[model samples]
Structures are given as structure tokens and as C-alpha cells.
Target: MHEDAARAFYAAVDEGAYDQLEELLTPEFVHDRPDQTLRGREAFISFMRDERPLTETRHDIEAVYVGESELAVRGTLRDADDERLLKFVDVHEGEARISAITTYTTQVASRLTEQ
Candidate 1:
């Protein structure tokens, strides 16, 4: 069930159905991005709307593991000009509503300015 929920979440994002995502997200849903963390469903929705304006977004899931109310999805994100490997951990409620999401990017960050 967790795996299915994870897949459905990604599918919704790929289809650009931001509204549908709300159904799968918990009220306290938290998304951890590379730069910051977004808390709450409203904040998450706003974040997606602002970030995902791409021509396309695709995810190729290599594996999915479910444990209790948690799901781990290992996949690759493919777009028109870039491809990124991503690993996502989703904590779900009884009804598959994602309560939290932690994502990791394969890209390495370089320091632009020395502190």
C-alpha cells in the first residue's frame, strides 16, 4: 500500500495535477528540498507550483520498499534537458496520505563563495 501511494504521488506530479496531490498529502506534510524544508500541505503545494514549471517531469522507479507506514522510492527524474537520480522517503498515514517527504539529489553542490 505504501509503495502504491508513493507511485501515485509521483504520478500526480508528473501529470501536473497539483490539486490531486492534496488528497495524498497529510495536513502536516513536510517536504525537504535541497536548499530548505517546506512544512504543511499548503506550503508544499505552493512550493511545487513555484518550482515545477518544466516542460516535462518523469520518474523511473528502480525500486520500492515498504515498512509499516513508511515508503522508500529509488528513482530517476528525466526532463527535456536533464536527468537526475533521486531517492525519496515518504512517511504515510493509515490512508496513504504522505505525512513527510525527504528527498536527496545526486548532484553535488559546490561552494560559490568561501565563508
Candidate 2:
């Protein structure tokens, strides 16, 4: 169920379905990254709407790890044509809402998928 939720969240973000975000996130959800943290679902939605609006974005999920209350997915963030932009691992907590995201822009050859 968490896996499905994870996919749905990513799909919603990639497709720019901002209206659906509230249903997928806790009202007080927190998103932490290396450079910034977004606290609360409204903050996340604002970032998605104003800062990270990439309508052609897609995730090619390669691995998923599930724990009692945590879910993690490792994937390639790709363009509409499937060209890799970054390698990322998104971590979700509390009812499958994403809590953190770590992204690698520096491609380690092992992580890159040959197009």
C-alpha cells in the first residue's frame, strides 16, 4: 500500500496535479533536503506550484525499501523522453507522505542508466 502511495505521490508531482497534493500529505508534513526543508503541506504545495513545476518530469523507480513506518524509493528523475536528470531517493514517513528527499546531481557511473 505504501508503494502504491509513493508512486501516486510521484505521479501527482510529475504531472503537476497540485490540487491532489493535500490528499497525499499530512497537514503538518515536513520535507527535508540538504539545502532546504519545507515544513507543512502548504509549504510543500507552494514549492511544487511555484518552484518545482516541471510538467515533463518523471521518475523511473528502481528500488523500494519498506519498513514498519517508513518507505524509501530510489529512482532516476527523468525528462519526458526518459533522459536522466538526477538520481534520487525519496523517503516517506507517516501514512506514506514523503518526509525527505535526497538527490544526486553528480552522476556516479554506477547509478546512471544508459539511454
Candidate 3:
């Protein structure tokens, strides 16, 4: 109930569970990111499933905030060896299914994780 969609999203992406991802996203889903914008669920899913640079990675969620019509999550993306790759904040908006997403990311430094 609380940040359920957001949590499901990260899980789906990390595990490459495209079926679950489709169920959680609207047909008109759009993603706006620092590097590029992906329009439509199909396009986004295609990119995630086939074209993304890093496929063997996972998101380690740090926090989630739920609002009336939006949800925001902060997390770090880690490689297969559990090395921190980057930090990201994603703001998602939708009703029953996520319709839109905006992502901000920064490369993580090895020193940050040494502690």
C-alpha cells in the first residue's frame, strides 16, 4: 500500500521481470531522465530489457516518500559484485499504474562506499 508501486518497479527492473513491470506501468508511461527521455511503456520496456548499458545490476533503495499523486524514491545502483555504481532519485506519478517518471542520477565514488 505504501510505496508499493515504487518498490515493485525497482524489483522488476533489477530482476528483469518484464511481466511484473508491465503490470505496474501504464500503457502511456513516459520516463524523463538526465540523459534521455523515453516515451511510452513499450519504448521504455524495450530499452530496459534490451538496450540498457548495465543489465547486471540492482537498486538498493534508501528511502521512499509517498504523496497524494506522486511517489519518490532514493537509491543506489550496485553492480553484480555489490560495488556501488551510482545514486539516483526517481519521482513517479500515477494512479493505479505508474504513468510518468523523472530520474536524476549521479555517479558514485568508490570512497563513499569504503566506509
Candidate 4:
């Protein structure tokens, strides 16, 4: 179930269906990345609209592992043209609705400023 939710979440991102994410994420949902942490689903949506990071993304889901309190997803982020940009593992927490997200990706981290 969580695996499906994770896939749906990524699918929403790839399709730019920002509104669709509301159903998959909790009101207090948090998105954690190497560079920043967005608290609340609204904050996350705002970031998505502002940054548009996944505009060219199409996640090639490698696997989804169900953990005690989280679902771990491994995948390669590809561009619209099917070019792999980076590999990542995202931890999704909570049941029914995703409450928290923690992403680990070295490729994206290297792009962040030291400051």
C-alpha cells in the first residue's frame, strides 16, 4: 500500500500534478533534503511551485522496501528525454498519508552551496 503511495507520489511529481499530492500527503507533511527541510504540505507545495525541481523528472523506480515506520524507495531520476540524472533513496513515513520524507542523494547534494 505504501509502495503504491510512493509510486503515486513520484508520478504526481513527474506529471506536475501538484494538487494531486494533497491526497497523498498529510497536512503536517515534511520534506527533508540535503540542503533544506520543508515543513508542512503547503510549504512543500510552495517549494515545488517555486523551484520546479521535478519539472524534468521522471523517476525510474528501482524498488520500494516496506519498513517498520517508513517505506524506503530506491530509484534513478530521469529527465523527460529518459536521461538518468541521479540515483536516490527516499524514506517515507506514516500510514495512509505520507507524513515525512527524507531524501538521500549525493548527486543533488554536490550541487548545493557550502554556505
lDDT of 4 at 49: 65
Which one is best on TM-score?
3
- Candidate 2 residue 47 Cα shift, in angstroms, is 0.9
How many clashes show up per model?
0, 0, 0, 0
Residue-level lDDT of model 2, residues 72-115, one tens digit each, is 88888887777777777777787556554444434533323332
Best by lDDT: 3
lDDT of 3 by residue, 58-99 (tens): 899999988899988999988888988889999999998999
TM-score of each: 0.76, 0.77, 0.89, 0.87
Q: Candidate 1 on 1-115: residue-level lDDT in tens?
A: 4677788888887787888899988888888767578899988887666654452657777888777767677777766555553433334444457888777666522320112
Give per-residue CA lDDT, model 4, range 1-115, as digits (tens).
3788999999888787898988899999999987789999998988776665446668888889998779899998876677777789999999899999999984772323333
The per-prediction CA RMSD against the true structure, in angstroms, equals: 4.5, 5.4, 5.0, 2.7
Cα-based RMSD of candidate 3: 5.0
Output the lDDT of residue 30, model 4.
Answer: 94
lDDT of 1 at 102: 76
CA displacement after TM-score superposition, residue 31 of candidate 3 (Å): 0.8
If ranked by lDDT, best first, what sequence of candidates would result? Answer: 3, 4, 2, 1
- Cand. 2 TM to true fold: 0.77
